[model samples]
Target: MAKKSSVFICGNCTYQTSQWIGKCPECEEWNTFEEQLQGKTPTSNHLAIKQLEKERPKLLDEIDINQEIRTSTGINEFDRVLGGGLVKGSLILVGGEPGIGKSTLLTKVLGNLSQRDVENRVLYISGEESTSQIASRMRRLGIENNQNMFIYHEKDLENIFAEIKIIKPKFLVVDSIQTTLSPELQSAPGTISQVREVTFEIMNLSKNQGITSFIIGHITKEGAIAGPKILEHMVDTVIYFEGDQNGYYRLLRGIKNRFGDSNEVGIFEMTGAGLMEVSNPSEYFLDDHENEGHGRCTTCILEGTRPLFVEIQALVVENKFGNSRRTTQGFDNNRLSMLIAVIEKYFGISLSFFDVYVNVAGGMKLLSRESDLCIIAAVLSSYFNKSLDSRTVWIGEVGLTGEVRSTPRMDIRLRSIQQLSYKKIITSKKNLESKEILVNNLAVNNISELKNIFD
Candidate 1:
């Protein structure tokens, strides 16, 4: 006989407590705790222990290393984000907001794989959609169904596993993990416990059977993957499909990867046909150059192995109200405030009574700290009612003392900019001193030196 009791679990962080509380201690989220009936704990560790006992540990030198096996989904952008391609026996999780093209992208990948692989054994199990709905989408995506690609509409974890065993699929995709539930678990499908257990079972299956699995997940209102934080930790790779619903461009960012680089990103554009890969993201982000007027400047950022050139625009208006508003889009708000303060302190430009607004073009978020110089230049150009040279590019980190510091991968960044045929590159003097740099470079030691160049 086993004991059962009631427990309160936080949906955001999986913090379990005997009593319900207003706030979660781990995540500090309010009203996220849900009461659920706890079932008897399973003594399954004995089996795992016995299985581990049979395996022998080998020295690093003794183990033979083979070429990592990868299956390209035929979507170059998707494959690039998956670190060259999908690895054998890897469990991948994809999360995004509704209508962000998570399903469309994966469906296209499956379709491509079906066409490429002669013995395509890809099973797409959907818990939320009916077979008809999926078929309709496949038609819209121009995916002609193959004999090997199977679709099953089921939500029961056991039933899904049974189908997997029978189909013996080389690749599996669960439309979503939240909708799948086990019969034995008393909790609802999307509960923390249910999500955690369901994911663990699927993970075990993928590892043991050497089947690659892609699990779709929903994000909470907080923009994090729904369910417990532990769910993200258990997967081999975690990818977030992000884009502005109104915009056609989409970014697939890999936040975690056990086998490859974690910061890899793939760019895509939504079209009538399907999710199309944007091979030249630079052209997409910097398509417009006619509006090189005051408050606009160009900058380069490194996204994984690729360097991207994007325009930064700023607007500084005299504030009518007592409190001036500081707004930023695709740029950090705190970083903007810091830049404004640096300008006021060092350059003697008082932005206290001016409303400052900054935006990074193309709906792309600016994550690089090196974008500081470009931002400052844009702000100054807007404040002084002057425009920077259209052919100039800014690259440097701004410190508190208004000194321009060298950024990492300076050589790589400069090479990318030079390839674009930019007339002048502005950065710290150290960059110009490097003999490897082969570009027309402008050296600026501090904010004062930077202002003099434009003046």
Candidate 2:
């Protein structure tokens, strides 16, 4: 009797579909199509009651702001990612693989907050762990359980909200969002729809209730935060706790930060108990290679706004067989090929008959173009069996024409070098023109001049 009802669908990157088709326009997953009841009426989400509540925000000029109210998490690296400190009414989403220390990091933050003498009680809602499992971790950590830190073992979203009302805690945490379910939806827990609904409600609560909430989200096989992409979009801040489980070190990257700069990342090491902060990263990167030779050199890489000194090792040997091998770790391979091409074309090194292997000393990956100058310098130094001065630094972008290009944040980079007590830097002439750039010594804008000095 009624006209055919239209089916609800995923318009972008659709993992699910409404009907079978030759090509899937959403998400490009051709056959991953599942249909649900199309005619069901959508219900008003009671999960997000906090957002539905009435509040009138005053104009900025009319309200007096407290600059000191932004709270620090007691971890310098974590605070850096959060852009100074935690803001009230901000929602943060953290995701990683199982046994990756996502829960451990959050627990550490909560432990510190529990020690504080504030009216705000930290509510840790653990939907995954039982009371006994949580107890074991606390015992291993050698930290006493907090009387003010309230723990819950519930998974129902409605009940979780009810507990929020009863406790009226200032800070809230959901150990994981996937385990929790809402009563309004007929779909099973962990469904795309349910995940989206639950997170939406939680984010709304943080804004309306003035509660800073931390939500631990599950990761997909692709290593991205699971559930709808919207789950990440809805939150004020999104961070990923990532590392090699077999390795000792861990990395935290801020993918989306509404309050602060997003490029910042924190590095930590996992101990027998919990994660210990890496106060001195340079020491961790340095290996036992005290003996130096022609093929080895030291390089400084710029991570975000911070500069870290690292060692680069290169090996060159004659290849007897055809198809010479060129391998590199931490440094990109294609970029190495480009550099080799430059060496052959510009310097006439004839590397096509040899095997070259390059590696950055630690288990770190270099992402920026600032490492270009150092990498090329190392390759050339090894090929010619020559060594560059260890006390100096080289930083510049390598153009296709084999010319060094100027990099951004030169002044900031110089300040980092000063802290490390480096004496000299070899860079492009464009950067030396700025009077504000004050370094200990200047070796600027003369790539040709630098080689001539060594000659």
Candidate 3:
């Protein structure tokens, strides 16, 4: 006999309570608690205990080290973000806003995989779309129907598992984890218990069968995965696909990875043909139109191992209202305010009544501290109504005392700038003295030195 009881679970963090509450104590999210029926099955517990009994602990030295095998998806940008290539038995969760090209990118990867080996079995299980609809998208992505690639439109977890057992696919893609349901659970498909159980089962399948799996997930209004936070923790890698709906570019960022470096980003352009990789992201992000302005400046930030040069644009205007507005896109608002205060304190610039707006070109977010100097330069240029040299690149972190600090991997940043044939590099004096690279370098120890550069 199974014992069943009603429980309240937080949708955001999967926090469980005996009764419903207005807000979740774990995640601090309001109105996220949902009532659900939880059942305890003794059979599952027995199975788990039996499974654990079959495994024995061994010494670390006793284990044999084998070379890691990685299969390329035939996309360089995608492979770079996946840490060289796709690792077998790895579970990957891909989350994004609707229509952000999560399905399209994976479809293209599957198409490429199908082309590589006609015998390799790849299974795509879609709970949201019909088989014909997926085929239509495959044709749009120029994927021809092949015997190796199979699509099964089903939402039942048992049926999906049955298909997987029959096919024994080397690779598996679940279009979405939310719509798949287990008959054993009384709650809806996207509930906390359902999602957690499904993910746990999928992980077990991947690890036991050595099948690489990619699970597509939907994001919430808060820009996080819609299901419980525990869903992200169970996967081997988590990737977020980001871009503006109206924009032509899309960015694939790796948020967590067990086999590769996290925070790796893959740049792509969404076109009629499909998602095309932007090889030279620096050249792609920096356009000539962005350079023909007073408030615009160039800066380089490393994305994973690749150095990308991006343009920072700032605008300063008189604030008719009492409270000056500070607006920014792809840049931190708090950092912008701090930089504005630094400019006012160090340079004695009266920008208290001016509204400041800063933007990082190409819809790319600037997370590195190295872009601090470039942001300051852009702000000052806009305030003074004087344009800085477009050929000059800024690379340094700004301190509270208005002193420039050296950033990490200064040598790599300098070499990248030099390769692009930039005329002058402005960085901390420490970086210039430490590196012997022969490039026209401008050493700036303090923020006040910037006042004389544009003059």
Candidate 4:
């Protein structure tokens, strides 16, 4: 028998060392190293290599192009984030904070897949919860009639694989990868070594067996998947649930996808039944009945291919004490500061002495630069205590010189605004020159012109 060796690994980046270090040189993270006992390496198999030698590499033209078959999870919003639908033999990793509806959403997905084909078998393996607990939750989700769905409560990797080999389910859901342990390793579950090994085995199983698999993962406090970075690289797609657990809305954002666009987003509302898709996210996000007041404005942004209208609100208050603070939610603080400088320089508004607060309604994070104009409008409205047209939408990016810049997909944004029956739009003059629009267009070349709109 070969003697076992011990090695230290970084939990964050999976950097390995013979000796434990206080800080990891690879990821620059401190105190993330954990020790693991490694077993003896297995001898190489000459027969397997001889079998591989029989296959020859082929040219790209030699490969046949066929339309990939996609199985819908019976959730439109989930399918949207998945680039249309789940592809066969694909390994998907879903990560989120605890109690953020990761299991609920995936449970619903299993139920949906089971209902699609009575002959097909779908399995749900849980490491954290009991089968009865999951069944009760499924009942609450109104998924009581899934005859083809099977649930197993097991954490041992060997037993799980044994069952997978016996059942040979078309779709598989692992409630979580952290709690699933490999008996071959001495490291505890959720450790870097165990996580990497478990994911590797599952990936091979999915690819070799043509099984569609979903693995639920826990996220760290820093809002990243709680495993080695290689865990994400090993999967076909990575999706994250974004929103406060207490909040009613959740946004599923695709981080990586090999088969489809990775920028796609899916919106869901947590309800008594389960996660219900929000068909019209624009209508759900915009508050139509609220009185138009200072510090509030509307803007349109594109998430993947979908256009959404979001409300931007700002509050400016005179700071009596220490330093003026700039606070924001769902908007970048550095960008807000730059926009404020532009407003003060071009509009001649002194906001340095005032504390500024900006927020995006409906808990939606604004990544698009097109919301810059709406944010500026909101801040100016709040500072001057004036209200702009409630039916108007602002869309444009602000340059350092205070020029309103054009944004991509302006036509799609305009059409969405018109669909919502918005009365007016304030954007760059360049965006208005080529097309005929139904609503009123308030085109401006510089931030100076925004003062006239506020007045």
Candidate 5:
């Protein structure tokens, strides 16, 4: 008998190898190779013809491209994150940690859309939950299963396609791609090969039928979505549900989108009834310790297209360990260290032997330089024991020489604060006070002017 040829596969990236290797050459993941079925020949590609048949010939001049009309969900926060509304024929992928409310969010979207008085129908297919469970959730969501909405409980791909054809829903949602299995492939659900095949099949359905489909996926222990990177590459948009399980807030971030900017995000606070859209993040970011004492200050950090005022609180105490203990929450620790060094070098603030801890209240992230001045001021306030004004909001970047610098999109930031009924805002003089710029009831400029206004 001839020696049979074997195929080795990397469980991490789904890369195949002819022989066994300790490390996967494609994804560089070590000890991730597993011996799949030994094949004398490559598996036939079913998707190649699907792709070939789907392409339509069109000339650049002949093709009519109109401005995109976004279909709003009537939820301002959701629309804001989605860059106005859902684009027709857009395939969206939502992935996240287990029990992170991925299914709940999609259910809410379907329920709201079904409530609209339109002729278009919507389909909600669940591979994870039962039909009865979906019915229960719909009732809880204040939605009754009506003619506009169709609920399905299935894991088989062929039947899913058959149902899609009969119904011809305007929008579609696959509750989870991991639980879905294809009969052609003899792999278990949630496995890398299975997930890839299942998702690719749905992507084809979305493209060929002009149905906007949302396929939900699960994350691995390392936080990356399970299956090959090819799965993410296949989708038109990728979104992730993020936040600690113990926390009350959930963050919806767009990691990739073909129709809109990928940086935008939505915040929702988990409530007794359901997830509530956080219209004004500043209300949660800034705490009531405003009238209490020092060690805390307000700062604005720009997230995608939205400007937000978050509180930066610090506590500086004499270090018992001598080397100083520095810790931060909702703020980057390494960046905090660099800012502390800059403050000490520029303003002669001795922080070598002090224990420093920084936190952004309400557990929201701060990713920009606008919080630099606020962190410095908060640290100083802790050391000097001076309480900052409750009505004031500060937004500026602090340079190495103690000079406050300007940030991008100052107009948006000030407008957000003004709309929130805030009375005072302190920013870089150069950015806001330009002779060509104009706004109403705006005051406070530069760090020097801010200090003077405070006294």
Candidate 6:
């Protein structure tokens, strides 16, 4: 006989309780607790021992490395973010804000993959959209309705798995795991329990059948995948699309990858013909050079193994209110405040009476602290109303005591700057020798030295 129990579970954090509560103590979210009925645990443990073809474990040198391979989606940007290409039997999760081009990107990949081989079958099961809706998008993307490409509107996990078993597709995509549910669970779609179970089934199906699967996930209001934290654990790779929805730019960031590097990022521009890869992101971000030095400066930072140059702009105005407002776009707000405090304490510059605004060009967020020097220089330039050299670049971190710190990959950054035809570069004097370099490299030990160079 099956037994049922009543429990309260938090939708945000998956915390369980015997009784319902107004707020979740773990996530501190109010009105996120829902009452649900729990079914008895199944007798068969899915993760337990499985009866299959067993092979003896071999030593490190005995195994052939050539057996494992990756399939290219024919999209360079997508392939770059996946650390070369998609591995067979890998489960990848893509999450982002609503209307962030997650579906569009995947649709384009499907089209490209289908065009690569007529015999390769790809199935895309959309639980949130109908066949007609997907077809309309395909037409807009100029993707032909080919025989190898398949689309099915399904929300039932059993039916989806049945179709997968029958077709034996080489590639699979689930529009979203939230809408797909199991028949045995009484919980509604998008619930924590339902999402967890559906993802587990998909993972098992992909691994057991050797199908490369891409699962789309809805994000929470906080911009995280809207399920238990373990949801990220079950997948082989997890990437998110980031950028301004209204803008033309999109950043693909890989947070977790079992097959490749996780710190890598891919840049793309959204256009009428789907997403287009940005071959030279530095040129795209620094397209405007008319008013370079007044409040703008360039800095290079490492994104995985690649070095990228981005522009930073700052503006200072007299404060109209009691408290000076500090606003930042594409940079951390708290970090801006801390930097302003450092400027005031060491340089004796009083930004207390001014409203400060900082922006990173092209709507891209910066996760590196190497841009600290450029950001500080832009602010000081705007404050003093001085114009810096247009062909100059700044690359270093700033300490609380007004010292400039060396950044990682100094040679790579310097080479990139020189390649871009920058006349001068500012960095720390710790370990670099610039006697043989073509571009003039000025080394500074502290922020005061940087300020003196401008003075």
What is residue 234's positional error in candidate 6, in angstroms? 0.6
For model 6, residues 1-455, the per-residue Cα lDDT tens digits are 75677898887678999998898889998877877788754333332113224458899999877755888888887888899998998999999998989999999888888888887789999999999999999889888858888999999887887787678788999999889887758787887888888888788777877889999999988888988778999999999998888899999999999999897899999898889999998888887764646788888888877788888999999986759999999899999998999889878779888999999988878888999989999999899888877688888889888888888768777778778899988888872654356788888888887667557
TM-score of 2: 0.88
What are the clashing pairs of model 1? none
Write one digit per residue (lDDT tens) for candidate 4, span 1-455. 97878999898788899999999999999988888887643233221121223447899999998899998888999999998899999999999989889999998898888887886788999999999999999899888877888899999987898888788899999979999987766778998877987887888778767889999999988899998889999999999999988889999999999989887899999998888999888878886725878899998898888888888999999998858999999999999999999998998778878999999989999987999989999998999899877789899999999999998888898887888788999999998888889999889999898676677
> What's the number of clashes in each of the models?
0, 4, 0, 0, 0, 0
TM-score, each model? 0.94, 0.88, 0.94, 0.93, 0.87, 0.92
Residues 1-455, model 1: lDDT tens digits: 76667899998788889999999998998988988888755344322122333557899999999989888888888887788898988999999999999988888888877778777788999999999999889989887757778899999987888788788888889989999987768888888888988888888788877889999999988899998889999999999998899999999999999988887889999999888999899889877765569999988888776788898999999997869999999999999999999989888878999999999989989887989999999999999889888778888889999999887777777777778788888888776674576667778889887656556
Taken over the whole model, the C-alpha lDDT of each candidate is: 0.86, 0.75, 0.87, 0.88, 0.76, 0.85
Q: Candidate 1, residue 305: CA error in Å?
A: 2.0
Per-residue lDDT over 66-156 for candidate 2, one digit per residue giving the tens place of the 0 to 100 score: 7646788888888887888889999999999999898888877877877776685888898899867776676677648567778788988
Q: Give the CA lDDT, 0 to 100, for residue 321 in model 4.
A: 88
TM-score of 3: 0.94
What C-alpha lDDT does candidate 1 achieve relative to the native structure? 0.86
Candidate 5 global lDDT: 0.76
C-alpha lDDT of residue 62 in model 4: 98
**lDDT ranking of the models:** 4, 3, 1, 6, 5, 2
Q: Which stretches of candidate 3 lie over 4 Å from their true place?
A: 1-5, 27-29, 42-53, 289-291
Error of 6 at 39 (Å): 2.1
**Cα lDDT, model 4, residue 418:** 83
Report the lDDT of model 4 for residue 174.
92
Q: All predictions: root-mean-square deviation over Cα?
A: 2.6, 3.6, 2.5, 2.8, 3.7, 2.9
- Candidate 2: worst-modelled 10 consecutive residues by lDDT: 5-14
